[model samples]
Target: MKAKQIRLATRPNGMPTYETFKWTEETVADPAQGEVVLKSLYASVDPYMRGRMNDRKSYVEPYEVGEVIAGGVIAEVVMTNSTQFEVGDIVIGNLGWATHQIAHEDSLRKIDPSKGPLTNHLGILGMPGITAYFGLLDIGKPAAGETVVVSGAAGAVGTVVGQIAKIVGAKVVGIAGTEEKISYLKHELQFDEVVNYKSENFQEELKAACADGVDVYYDNVGGTVSDAVLRLINKYARIPVCGQIALYNLEKPDLGVRVQPNLLVNSALMKGFIVSDYGAHFEEAITDLAKWLKEGKLQSKETVLEGFEKLPEAFLGLFKGDNIGKYLVKIAEPSE
Candidate 1:
């Protein structure tokens, strides 16, 4: 069968545009004894995938120019030679941007749709949720009644961070760009305080909202936004550096306020981490998240763009802050 794919056309110098991706068609090879043919169902677009576009050394290898761009994907087993899976079984994995492909059984995890929507596997109960769990619980250990501030508080990981913080009894304050997002975070998500970072009085607003000082800072967007939040750290505060979305697209270094003094005066602990850092504890984290979701203690919101061709657009929109909660692209539905 012929499959469509999105590949990295070139290493982006700044913000990646549509031109940065190349779409092509290829014939999928038949499955071998241990493999199965996968029909794409849903694909996830995240801020971290942008980091992979650049040709630099990081936790994960950079995407080669002219190679398929791969990330978390939900797919259905269309043809299988493996006993672990049968045709029409839905699964999730680190798959390519292609509409169809062949993968070994070990590379995929079968999904239990009864637990939640299939899309949730790529959002709340998947990478983003797990990232929020470890980053907040393991690093920014928020105590009851303490102030917890999260930048990029409306995005995939940020939303989860704020919700999980509230679950732990912390007072949650969210920093976002648009008024709509601010409203949603404040009213819908029940955040204690929501500040619009794009407002002229952002610093003033944030200071007022976090008058008691920030005990836990979930830094998803690094840059001026993070600079503002870092200034309000309480003594012995903990900061979990998750994503630097604002700085990811910069062609040159972004020099801002020095943060060492803030850390020094407060004797705070600041650490950077990728979700994979807590891979060993994913099962536990997922169990807790799923339980919260089932009990209505946790809510998930997703912005989905239909069609496989919209993958690049959905991804580029992340830098533009075009989504709230989790952003996903629905490629196809499972036949089963």
Candidate 2:
């Protein structure tokens, strides 16, 4: 079988561009024993993938300059030699930018589509959801009647953080870029308050929204936005640094207000975490999230683009804040 994959053409200085990627086709060998050929159904494009594009040492190794860029993918088995999987079974794994892939059965988890849309496996029920669950519950630790504020509150992870805070009886406030995103967070998600960080009076608005003072701050976007939120933390506040999307594309170092003084004076606890930190408890978190989703207590939204060719475009849109909830690309459908 033939598959086209996206590859890194060059290391990105900051925000990646069309010139940063190259597309190529490869011949996929037939599945060997214990292996399967997968047709990509849906795949996710996230902010973390941006970090991988940079030639830097981080939690994960950088994507090799000439190899295929890989991430979360939901696929269907087209051919299988393993008894554990059937020809038509849907599966999930850390796969490639290609439309099809060959993988060992152990590498993929069978998906039960009855739980939700298969795309959910790449979104609300996948990495972004897990990231929100642990980062907010374990780190932010919002309590009833306390104030919880999330920057990038309209994003995939940020939206879920706010909803979960409300579930735990916290007053949820969200800071986002556009009025539309702000409206979705406030009106659709029922967030207690929403602030437009791009507004001229952003600091004032956030101050007024958090009049009771922030008890838990979920920092998805660092840099200036985080700087503003840090200034308003109450004594013993909790800040979980999820991702600094604002700083990911920087071509140069961003020097700004030092945060040590703020953390020192407020006696706040600030920690950075990746979702895998709670891998042992993923089942517990996913079960709870699934329950809430089934009961309509939790809602998920997504910006889905069609076709394999749109993968790069979809990823580029993430930094521009083009999507609501989770962003995904639908590559193909199962023949079965």
lDDT of 2 by residue, 184-293 (tens): 98889999999998999999999999999999999999999999998899999999999999999988989978888888999899999999989899989899999989
Tens digits of per-residue lDDT, candidate 1, 1-336, equal: 999999999989999999999999999999999999999999999888888998899898999999999999999999999999999899999999999999999999999988889999988999999999999999999999999999999988889999999998999999999989998998899999999999999999999999999999999999999998998889999999998888999989999888998899999999999888888889999999999998888899899999999999999999888999899999997884
Candidate 2 lDDT score relative to the true structure: 0.91
What is the lDDT of every predicted structure here? 0.93, 0.91
lDDT of 1 at 207: 98
lDDT top scorer: 1
Any residue pairs clashing in model 1, and if so which? none
Q: Where does model 1 exceed 4 Å of error?
A: none
